[model samples]
Target: MFSYNSALMKHKKIHKGEKEFICLQCGKRYRRRIDLAYHVRIHTGEKPFKCLVCGKTFCFKSSLTSHERLHRREKPFGCLECGKNFSQNIHLACHMRIHTGEKPFKCLECGNRFGQSRTLANHMKIHTGEKPFRCLQCGKSFRQTANLSSHMRIHTGEKPFKCLQCGKSFRQRGHLASHVRTHTGEKPFSCLECGKSFSRGSNLARHMQSHRGEKPFKCSHCGKSFCERSKLRTRQQIHPG
Candidate 1:
């Protein structure tokens, strides 16, 4: 037999699916009045919690605690799979999906899935044809802000990713990772049919096309089929000459 405290009894409402406190602004329900008060601050834009180290303000105390970890260079959460440390537990949880290859978030517009909700949100913009991020230099728009950032790097000629093996640097991390594979001789992507391996997935895809003799791309003007886009372009050049 166990005795229930009145304070503990109040929290039991959450498990019972009782959300008594409702927000006046968004009509979002909360189990407790204190939780509702915190939610109300979001609409009011009231950041009561302030970081002493960086003077950064957060709406919630938990957010302030997370921000403090960045200033302190403290990573409380560690991924058991890869031994990677993260400042927040949510980040570690997201990182685990990379090892597990678990893509939980799926797009309703298309059957395409993503490891994270943010990636799914970015993918949805492709179907909607919404380009929120615009480059001021060329007036070019992108569906994702990250793509715009990468485009800006091309204009700026900023190569942030540097290789440890050689002094070679790349504008993108993906490019750097591929370049590093040249030094390591790591060919992770392999063909299941021939057991042939390639450094890049694109190369493996092209290799598979050779095995199948699949001429997918056809020249629009000549109607001549080619195994690759470059081959089709080459055929067009011959016609023009």
Candidate 2:
């Protein structure tokens, strides 16, 4: 019943970016008058669409329609690579990047790539030293949100990373690797000063600081000092006099 000539004319009009529907209240324009009317309800808080099953209300009919699909267990969008189903097309599009390795989001300063815009925004915080994500366990903060999520596990005593060799669980991959080196006697980090090697860089750094007599750790109470901060705290607790 649709004419080819009429369809072509409609396509041309759409390409021209014509604003036929204009909102009288805010002077905002839309392609369709129904969409403009739906947007105007945001300012009025006029929820016209109501759900019968759960008694949920929505301002727009389209939102109510999408909400109804949740009860029906309908997933219209399916990922071609993983066969994973998504309720919305936007989620499906984002999932596709995992297979394609297409990083559209890029950091302006560091030129680092990310699949999501939010990840790229978070990466920028590292350069700025903005610790937005905080750990409730030790009151420690990190620039990245993922680091905060990982830090929360420390409070919960959740060691998710497991080693297959010894069937041991660790809070972090670095900790697990250091534990494995102890079993294997693998000292990867070498000290240039004493020709002594350590399994971890942290141990080597601590050992080197002892050789240099670099007692950076200071006591808050009586101006006492130690090579390590933990040693200073321990000494302070023992000799409070």
Candidate 3:
């Protein structure tokens, strides 16, 4: 219950499901006139809220406040478990799932679960077979814009990820990470069954098949399975007529 009648009357409108203010542009309704004014600014391109320090303007006062946090380097929201800080409270709440292992987003198509909503959205595109991002150079298509950007680096010979130790360069960050393991001899991926370690997760996956006696990778030419993709690729090269 609100102490003020004005505040109680505003709360009563929510219970009554009243959206008196309507936007003429989109026909979207809002309970308050101030909310309608905020929505109208999207179409009007009116940003009255300006940062005094940077002169960067925002459509809303709250957005301007969030933007100002970047200049101040203020991260008030801190994670209790990990001690990681975030400028926004929502980001810190999302980071809590790393320790919790909470897959909040689920796919209706394949029943796959993801920690992030954006990751679930990307996975949904796989079911629709939608590759919106396309490369102009080779006419190659990718599900993500990041993949298209990496594919473009092939034509341009752009290796942004560079190794400081060997001065070696790689187009992809994952490739550079694997290359760095060669110098450091860091075997991170370890098998729970055998305790055998691998530099890459793919290598560990292939190693796991040996323990399981499962040969999933079948030769397209022959009906025989090689237990690993690299071994199957090698066998496919030699065609036995």
Candidate 4:
């Protein structure tokens, strides 16, 4: 058994690209002999570490230890700011950004920032115009895989997000969140000029236009402008009742 300090030293060798041990079955190189032994089990299909509670078998002792935590219902990693618990340290680290407002990941094209690497990757697709995720049912393509998954629910008639208060279901979680605000009477968005709060950010933005007298919304039929988009939409008969 290697000590904690010895294990750290051995792990550093991997980052340095120093492979001391080689796998006999696959010719894969490993810095530590323990790691080489663990790799060999993949070829042999050997799971020596067994869970006493669930009877689940794992190839590595470390994997077994992590699995046992699930049975114990223990979340070792916790956020200090929110009191939220996570199964892994990486998840807890990601959660910390919510309180810190630290956006480490940034887009190279637009210089837009995001807290998570996955969000930055998704934003890159907007600039690239790469819609790889395709729906088989409708043959519609989406930039994000999550959008395609949500689209599939339309064909399946699956309303996953249910409102606890009114029992009304929504297709998307954001819609459910907005629906929840209606029940709670939570108006998070506020106009800076008038100090009047609104439930949605778009409502606040439209209200701000009134103070500035900026008529961005134009009617295509008459070339008439209005401070609020709702006014132009109403005149054009385009606004849904």
Candidate 5:
């Protein structure tokens, strides 16, 4: 009866947030020492979870379970709005925000909202003018670490994105998208005044400035006005000639 009572007490203690187990090896205490013992195995890379289907071993049972799901193709959690399913509940929760228009993550600096906290944190740098990520090659700075990583490829001359239509390679996806538009001749953005269409939004915005007479870029030499910076350069070249 004492052994049975001890076993029941040990089980109840975990539920009641009791740290009964202490590791002699690391001097770490755990509520259920079994959990501490299991964690210690992580440092040693001791994987006990074995898959019966393929005889594969995993460091954790949860990892093994996720791996098993991949083999089974079982996606129990699904987005009700889009019919897109996910293996995890957290992923489904994130996906649901797209349909519900829920932006819980907000930038404190500019009040910019994002679906994810990491994205909001990244956006906040734009308001603060903080570029933490720097390129080693050109000393150029970027707001996001991914942008710095992508810029490093410029030094290496690595063009990962390739146009399937023209066989041209580009460093950025936006550049690839613009190149592909040239092949398709799809000008989605159009000027309201002239009805002239452009493949890119920035190009359309620059075109609209022509009708509005908006010269955002001014020449430093003579303060000459021009719709686009390229046109301003052309005017500057004529001055030299």
Candidate 6:
């Protein structure tokens, strides 16, 4: 029960499924007037809230508070399963799915499930082939904004991802993760056919083809085929470019 009369009235609206405030621009309805005000910022492209640490703008003050924690390297929320820390409670919730292997979001198109909604959204673009984010320098497009941001590094030569082992740098985070496996001798990927392990997933995939007798790479010269591209390259030399 609500303590105040005003709060009790607001609680009744929740039960009645009533949304008094509605946005004129998008026709989206909100329970409270303040929520509708926040929704309007999306159409107007207005982000008044700014982070002092990184100078990043946000639409809401609550978002600014969450962004500030990143600058201080403060992870108040901790995962109970693995004891992993996260800056926000939402991130900790997402991490818990790893331990339980829970996939709540399912793609209607492919029937593939994902632990996170963002991943499901990213996967949806693969079917549509809609590349909205484009690189200004090379005119190359990417389905996700993160991919476009990573593609921009090719022209800018920005190697932000660094390794502690050899002080080596890479343009992408995945490259850094693979490089880290080298120092630890961690072969996470394995072949089911032979139980053979490989440091990289690409290596494991190529190894799997040997068991299936699949030669994906083919030569146009004499109609010869090989499982590995390197062998195809060697065979292509006889034909000449």
- TM-score of each candidate structure, all chains considered together: 0.80, 0.50, 0.73, 0.68, 0.65, 0.74
Candidate 2 Cα deviation (angstroms), residue 27: 6.9
Q: Please write out the lDDT profile of model 5 over residues 1-241, one tens digit for every residue.
A: 4469878887787688878677777777898756887878867889999999999999888888877886898998877777898887777888888888999997766677889877788887777899998887788999998899788987899999999987999999888998899989999999889799999999999998888889988877788878898988887886754
Model 3's lDDT to the true fold? 0.92
Candidate that would win on TM-score: 1
Q: What does candidate 6's lDDT look like per residue over 1-241, in tens digits?
A: 7799999999899999999999999899999998999999999999999988779999989899989999999999998777889998899989999999999999999999999999999999999998999888879999989888988889999999999999999999999999999999999998888899999999999988989999999998989999999999999999866
Best-to-worst ranking by TM-score: 1, 6, 3, 4, 5, 2
Point out where model 3 deviates above 4 Å. Answer: 1-8, 11-19, 22-29, 42-47, 50-57, 71-76, 211-241
Per-model lDDT? 0.90, 0.85, 0.92, 0.89, 0.85, 0.93
lDDT of 2 by residue, 170-221 (tens): 9887789999997899999999988999999998998889999999999888
lDDT of 3 by residue, 1-241 (tens): 6899999998999999999999999999999999999999999999999999989999999888878888999998999897989888778878888889999999998899988898898899999999999999889899998899999999999999999999999999999999999999999999999899999999998899899999999987877898888888899889776
Two-way TM-score contest, 5 vs 6, winner: 6
Order of candidate numbers by lDDT, starting with the best? 6, 3, 1, 4, 2, 5
Candidate number with greatest lDDT: 6
How many steric clashes between backbone atoms does each model show?
0, 0, 0, 0, 0, 0
Per-residue error for 84 in candidate 2, Å, reads 2.9
lDDT of 4 by residue, 150-198 (tens): 8898999999999999999999998898789999999999887989998
Poorly placed runs, candidate 2 (over 4 Å): 1-16, 20-28, 40-76, 160-241
Candidate 4 ranges with C-alpha deviation above 4 Å: 1-31, 35-73, 211-216, 237-241
Instruction: Give residue 89's lDDT in candidate 1 (0 to 100).
Output: 90
**What is the per-residue lDDT of model 1 for residues 1-241, given as tens digits with 9 covering 90 to 100?**
3266866777687689989899988789988888898889889999999999879899999999988999899998998877889999999899999999999999997899999999999889989999999999999999988889999998999999999989998998999999989999999999999999999988899889978999999987889898888888888988864
Candidate 1, RMSD to the unseen true structure: 3.7
